[model samples]
Target: MNKILIIGAQGMLGQELLKIFPQAVGWDREEIDITDEKQVKQKIIDFKPTIIINAAAYNAVDACEQAAEFELAKKINGCALGYLADVCLTLNATLVHYSTNYVFAGDKKDGYQESEPPNPVNKYGQSKLLGEREILRRSNLKYYLIRTSKLFGAKGKSTMAKENFFAKMLILSTKQIELRVVDDELSNFTYAPDLAQATNILWQESHASGIYHLVNANPRTWYEGARALFDILGKKVKLIPVAADEFSRPAKRPKYGTLLNTKFPKLRDYEEALEEYLKDRN
Candidate 1:
């Protein structure tokens, strides 16, 4: 069995990776801190892993809004990636990393494709994209960069862009819970376990490389997803859907950030994936 090291082991996706990688072996932050390159290098040297999955990320979306914290965010999101790539290269191990669809220009007449050039709308996405480029450019280690969207899990509900829009509508026990979900912002929600399984399978197969879009099969608006969320929770609420123009934020978002999974259609649609996720959660 191949030994695997997973950074960000306590995170939603990292936890999923631990469950999926029968060969996956590594720390839970109680064991290591990925942001520390010295520790990362020492751990890799000791584990002598065949595969390295980096799930560490500074994922707080609005945290990037502050100018003072941008550098720290870059260290966690980008520089750490570069360090991981370097360590993986030294060990001659396959390195797997996660990225977001946020890296793209975000405004495409058609949904963004892996082939499309990246133009991040925010500092967080920009840092991640930079990490992607740095890893590819600097490392000789075999690598897989899987770009995912709108991740949700059973743990603490965090606002990973569109998670709450749907989760919020689910708890609408009252007619007072009116949600003004943005119709203009397009997306596909990816469940973590599904993503982890698909990713490791692709990696294990030995032909997976370059950027692959690993999102749920269907494209949707936030309002539709929220309605689905409420429906799944066995609740009925008057969801007051609104346009993206109605809501304003510090960072600009791609009006149509839908990613098309031309490479991995066998993965199933967003609805099917969500159905499985809901079933597990319940």
Candidate 2:
């Protein structure tokens, strides 16, 4: 039997991964500090897992622009992977990690493919790219680097969890009759459950270790996504589409960061996934 271990088990995607791989041992930051090399090695060595899935990430994109937060993000999203990969290489464990679409420069209007080179526009993206290089640079390392975007589903149980875009829109709907959302930036909206299932498929099929883009089919702007959410909920909130510059953000976001899934069979469309999410949430 292949023993599997899931780090960041309490996270949004991690929670869904646990359901997909029920036999896998799950660990949150409380169990093992991935940033601590000694602790990370000891924990994985003790578990002796054949596969290691890392779902933890420093996801505060805007905050990463600050020097202090950038360092923390780099440590968690970048250096922490080095720690995990060191152990995976030592144990010959297949390492599965998630990355963001933000790694791309976002100039391509058509969206990004798995083969495209990454040029991050922000500190968060920089940190994630660092982690990707750590895994890829190791020629002997067996790893899966999945790049996804705009994830939504159940909020994570961890304190570090932030409400996803859809959740935030829902809350704003209750408070305000009208809302302004950015329409210029484009990216796919991924459902956490769908992503988890796809990750399991990759592992179960023993797919080759390489970069993969896993996200819902359609690429839409944040404004479009909000419109879809309100439509699905049958809410009457007025949504105004505005340019990205209207709101001041600490981190500079790419105009287009959609992760085009050209590797595995395409997952269901975002609208379908969003509907399922609404049902599940209710």
Candidate 3:
């Protein structure tokens, strides 16, 4: 049996990995600190896994505005990814790393592809892109960079979907409900279970080692995404369309974070995936 090890196993994607790969070993935040290169290296040595999937990342969007956390993500996601790449090289193991589409600045009208050059507008994107570049640099190692976007899952407890910010406006039962959503921002929404399944489809095939844009096939504005989400929740929610400049935040969100995969059979359109997710959701 191939020993598969997953870091950040408590998160949305990680939780789905455990379900998809029943026998894999998983490490939560308490179990392993990905920031420490030495600890991660040692963990690999101890586990002696045949494949290592890193789902760990500093995903705090607002917090990434701080220089310290942004630097931390680079150290953990990039530096540590490099460290693990060396380990995989030494141990002769396969490595799968998760990345974000924020690597692209979304200046172009079309979606990002596996071949497009990255120009991240924020610190989070910069850090994750650096990680992708660092780990992928090792030619000898078996590595796959899976770039995904707008992930949500039931297993992910503290997700933005679970928040009431959008719900209050969507459910709109109370008179105090006043909501504003960005119409300018566009992205490909991905559910964690679907992403996990798609990743597994490629991971199961030994030859699937390369950069893949793994988000859902369709693109939607932030309002549409929220509307679909509220529809899934069975709450009556209406999103007031606004521009990117309407809401003031520390970091800038990508206007179009859609990632197009022209070749993957396992991936489907975002609308299809969303329908599936909402259809079965409780």
Question: Candidate 3, which segments miss by more than 4 Å at Cα?
Answer: 155-176, 231-235, 279-281
Residue pairs in clash, model 2: none
Q: Which regions of candidate 1 fall more than 4 Å away from where they truly are? A: 156-165, 172-176
Model 1, span 1-282: residue lDDT tens: 677888777677877887887566746656876678899788779878878888878766667867866777788778888888888788888888899988987778589878888999888788888888877796356888889888876553223323333454555545465667777778778888888888877886786667788887677888888778767667767777797767766667777788877776456777777777778867
Q: Candidate 3 on 1-282: residue-level lDDT in tens? A: 799998878777888888999999988777887777788788788889889998888777767879888888788767878888888888899899999888999877788778899999988888888898887778888988898887765545324223222333434435636457788988787778888888788888764678888887678887777776677667765458889898888789888787888657646776676666656554
The 10-residue segment with the lowest total lDDT in model 3: 158-167
Candidate 2 Cα outliers beyond 4 Å, as residue runs: none
Kindly report which residue pairs in candidate 3 clash with one another: 170-236, 170-237
TM-scores, each model vs. reference: 0.91, 0.99, 0.90
Q: Where is model 2 poorest over a 10-residue stretch in terms of lDDT?
A: 256-265
Instruction: Single out the weakest 10-residue window by summed lDDT for candidate 1.
Output: 156-165
Selected candidate, larger lDDT, 1 vs 3: 3
